[model samples]
Target: MDSAFFSMIFRMKYITRWGLMRSSYPETLSEHSMDTAVLAHALACIGASRLDKPVDPMKAAVFALFHDAGEIITGDMPTPIKYHDPQITEAYKRIEAEANRTLFSMLPDDLKPYYEPVFHPAKEDEAYWQYVKAADKLSALIKCIEEEKSGNSEFKDAKAQLLSMLSSFDLPEVQVFMQEFLPAFSKTLDEQSRE
Candidate 1:
């Protein structure tokens, strides 16, 4: 009898196209998760040090790593398509919830309890959640930066909306990063940020 060994699966992506990190353009789920985890760690440390709000950097990183594990089933939905309206937003959430269910189900039903904490994170750990959300935003922002630098303004609107969303969120350290560090993102391309 074969056991359900947790091994990575190399499957073909059908409908979903485009992936993370333009440097490695058309990256994969595996690649995106790796970047998200590492970036989450760095952002958590920045938040703790500069904002005086300490976070469990390691746990936050883990959260980021698994944040899109659900995508293994649902596939990456482009932001424009995902957020076109409240109906679409709700539909996407439903898709995510189902993917989350599928991931835990991959474990022995009896052993699923152990993975719960990591998969369905607690909002009670506010700082960790903040890092997860910030890391998500940052990854998209980096993608946007790369697009703009490539002379493709396709992501310009997304960059602006994401920056606006980040602005209204009361995360002081993120706010500071946007003000000071973000401009450098564009200047690195020999151009100033459009916003």
Candidate 2:
């Protein structure tokens, strides 16, 4: 039987993020996932190479790609409402978990074992998950930066909030990326090319 998995995953392009705010350029879930995956790979590399930590860059990238897969079913619940209180946060987590399970069920039985960890990360991969989380926040931070650079103040507060959240992460890899690469997001193409 043909699996609907890939087809359902492709619908990520139709799910726009930052739905509550006006954006100069709307970002799709696919775009966000790609951005997160790239960032996750970089962070993992930084950890393994520069920080001398054991991190599988490929795994991080793959995990990041599927990190928000459930959002397709949840319709991108706005963060404010999703995390307004402990009860709502707990409820949303349950809903998200169910959504992920539904997505997982779409895969062929033979492939289920391989994709299991992608949907529900193993406990041993906690360190890698931290990197994914940091990368996810970095993606949002980049989005906020882009929005502000586009003269949209709607994301200004979000940018600050993301900055604070990222700063709280003790991962030196995150700090390295923030310091070395993130600044380029604020520059013009010409300015970046000259540097």
The top-ranked prediction according to lDDT is 2
Candidate 1 is scored at a TM of 0.77
> Over the stretch 1-195, how does candidate 2's per-residue lDDT look in tens digits?
889898889999999999899999999999999999999999999999998897899999999999999988888988888889999999999999999999999999999998989888889989888988999999999999999899999998888999999999989899999999999999999999999
Tens-digit lDDT track for model 1 on 136-157?
A: 7877777678778778766777
Name model 2 segments beyond 4 Å from true: none
For TM-score, the strongest prediction is: 2
> How many times do residue backbones clash in model 1?
0
Question: Where does model 1 exceed 4 Å of error?
Answer: 1-5, 8-24, 109-114, 179-184, 187-195
Residue clash pairs of candidate 1? none
